[model samples]
Target: MALLPVDDALQLILADARPIADIEHVPLHEAWGRIVAEPLIAMRDQPPFAASAMDGYAVVAADTAEPGATLRVVGESAAGHGFTGAIGRGETVRIFTGAPVPQGADAILIQENARPLETTMIGVVEPVQAGRFVRRAGLDFHRGETVIAKGAMLDAGRLTLAAAMNLPALPMHRRPRVAILATGDELVPPGADPRDDQIIASNSFGVAAIVKEAGGEPIDLGIAADTLAALNRSIDAAQAAGADILVTLGGASVGDHDLVRKVLESRGLELAFWKIAMRPGKPLMSGRIGPMHVLGLPGNPVSSLVCSHVFLTPLIAKLVGRTHHVQAVDAILDVDLAENDLRQDYLRAAMHRRPDGTLVATPATRQDSSMMRVFAEADGLVVRPPFAPEAKAGDAVRAILLRHI
Candidate 1:
């Protein structure tokens, strides 16, 4: 088959993919980063009453219209226990912060502006205005109103708002479970002694980090040797674990030792597409095995990691009902770049901001796919289209940011 364009391959992988419909109810304390499955409705108005915002005396605004006006203090209104009697003309009530505003009292005279004449009377030294220092009913929100829409992520501010809405728990989308398997005869787990010809397995950890950051749970299936039997055993374990997505590293190309697709095909894998038209990730493959989605990533450390950021993160986000995608912002090029290839290129680039606040992206001199250090130091990937013209320093370009910066 002809090499699939990057965009086309992505469309095929998610053509039938839908966000998980399962909903799990969790307490507000455990809700951070989870997608909301239901609208957050307010059970009652915040504060539930017009309360005092300061330690002061509640009096009729007209009664305190003149300076040095003496008013009789009827009773005290504290939080949770409000003064029930009405304040007649020339009358006031002792109130504290958060206390309910007493009836017939339209304003508050703070203690700083009042002089206690005796136990039952107080003199107002300053003129007061109506509705001053009184919090209105339902100022924040009303009862039975939807405060948060569905599909919103429960962040710190949103979670606190939900608590104030009288909700002890919230409905959230189920976290996606991703099964990660590394396949190679020359691979071993980290901290294990590797023969001269072998190297420690590290790609799965990077991919797992991406999965977790996208709000998915990652399950390590360990390293599988090149043999089909070994690969099949790991795949079986993934299925048994009820994994939503199966991610296989290495063994994706057409080499004799590359058996990821062969093993997946034996399990009736419906191949979607392979050999994307992109540099450093040409041998990428994607498909579905029964109910589980499968992604075959390239063996090179940088290639696998870049593809995870470009492909896997969005897939995990979608599975958990979050709207996510790769984004590229325009930046100024800091160096000359040669181009003209059939496949698109994503060059590791460092980002810097000018004193005037303009962003500049400079591609590294070395972009070998096996170098993890280059990828680590890079803040973004400068995207160059297939068969694009050469670019010069100071040219305008677009780059996909690695971090929000």
Candidate 2:
């Protein structure tokens, strides 16, 4: 069978994905980083009335027209407390920031511009124009207005705004639950005394991190030995946990011990595609068992991570209604590169910025997929298209950054 193109495989995995319909009401404090399921409408106008913007006297603009005019202090207005009586001509109200402006007052005579007189009055030192220092009602937001629209992520700022909108709780979509299973008898959990032949299972942890960063909840199924019964038990556990996606690490390729695909197929998985035309992650598999999406990732550490970035990230993003895009930036190659082959290449490279702000990428001398140390030390992956010609140093190339430089 022909290997599927990377783009085609990704499209198939995400084509049928729809935003989760399971909605839950979450308290304001816990709503952060959750997707809003319904519009958050303002309960009342911000401030709900004309308010003083500064700690000054609230007065009719006309009353402060004269440079040295004296006005009687009618009442005081502080935050959450308003002067009930109206402000007549030649009258002013002692007010502080966020205080509601007394009725019939159109401006504020700032304290710096006002001189204190007897206990009952203040002398105007400077005049303030009408509407000056007065925050109009509904200036920030009006009652019944949509403060936050549906499908918006409740970030810090958005959550604050929702709280200001008088919403104690927000309707949010349920976080997508992803079940992660590691396969292979040669694997052991981290912090275990593994035999010389067995290696610690590390791919699930990285994949789980990616799942979380994509706004999904990761449910670890631990390491499953390379056997049909073990794989079946894990699959059942994932279903019991109501996982939306099942990610199987290792046992995906066409090796004698590769049984992830076979086991999933027996469970009635509708195979989407297996094997992608890309280096470092060629033996990738994607399918769906009923409502649960199934992804069989390669066993190699680098391959699993690269595939996660390329395929699984987008799938989870789609499920949660988050926009996902691969950020690729142009860079100048600092070293020569060989011509391409049938598969797309992702070369791990170090990155530097020139004094002129130009980015430079230097691919590692060794590009082995299992070299976790080399992959860890590199900054990003330099993308090489299939069958591209050899390029010399100083050539322009595109690299996908793993982190900020």
Number of backbone-clashing residue pairs for each candidate, in the order shown: 0, 0
Give one digit per residue, the lDDT tens place, for model 1 in 133-233.
99988989999999999999988999899999989999999999999999999998989998999998999999999998899989999999999999999
Q: What is the C-alpha local distance difference test score of each model?
A: 0.91, 0.90
- Cα misplacement distance, residue 374 of candidate 1 (Å): 1.1
Instruction: Give the clash total for candidate 2.
Output: 0
Model 1, residue 9: displacement in angstroms? 1.3
What TM-score, computed on C-alpha atoms, does each candidate reach? Answer: 0.92, 0.94
- Candidate 2, residues 225-318, lDDT tens digits: the string is 9889999999999999999999988898778888888899999999988888899899888888999999988899999988988888898888
lDDT of residue 21 for candidate 1: 92
Off by over 4 Å in 2: 81-84, 118-120
